[model samples]
Target: MTIAPSDSALAPALRGYADHKPDHLARLHKIEGQVRGLTRMVDDDRYCIDVLTQITAATHALQEVALGLLDDHIRHCVQEAVRADQDTGETKYAELTIALRRALRL
Candidate 1:
């Protein structure tokens, strides 16, 4: 089961996010530049295939960031939860499982 962000008591779990804030910011900045380049490509009437190739590269880069964040969450947050207790730890594990499923689009 998925807990909606607005409904959850947990205040936006971002353990991994906080840990990698600088890295994420840097990657996002690069992605922003790529987006600007894509916009310029469109505005300058570049070839459709070239623009699409850029788009694909940008998407893959974003996915890499996402996977890294997810890994950190599992290694830090989820691991802590499981180590802390059994009952609620199980819940945390379930929560992480759901997250992994969603991340993997399973």
Candidate 2:
């Protein structure tokens, strides 16, 4: 079997998430604000449970962003790689699995 270059090795004109990038950034910005709020909460000696709740919200927000990006990666990058060739497709799928492992902290 021949190894093929990964889709991620080359940059495409537009990424799968290109169209939704603005929305993604907006959500990230909101998460950033949530982080800043957490900082303030700690500094102000806010209740422990409240801080935990905010942390959970922030974590959930980040997870949502991640899920969106993952979906885009599969739909665009993986699909393109598979279209290129079976070897490239398999490579991309393996790469995605490793990435998911890291993301999920498994």
Candidate 2's residue-wise lDDT over 55-96, tens digit each? 999999999999999999899888998999997889888878
Candidate 2 deviant stretches above 4 angstroms: 1-9
The global Cα lDDT (0 to 1) of model 1 is: 0.81
List, residue by residue over 20-70, the lDDT tens digit for candidate 1. 889988998999999999999999999999999999989988988888888
Checking candidate 2 for backbone clashes, the offending pairs are: none
Model 1 alpha-carbon drift over 4 Å, by segment? 2-14
lDDT of 2: 0.89
**Total backbone clashes of candidate 2, pairs 3 or more residues apart or in separate chains:** 0
**Candidate 2 weakest lDDT stretch, 10 residues:** 1-10
Find the 10 residues in a row with the least total lDDT in model 1.
2-11
Candidate lDDT values, in order: 0.81, 0.89
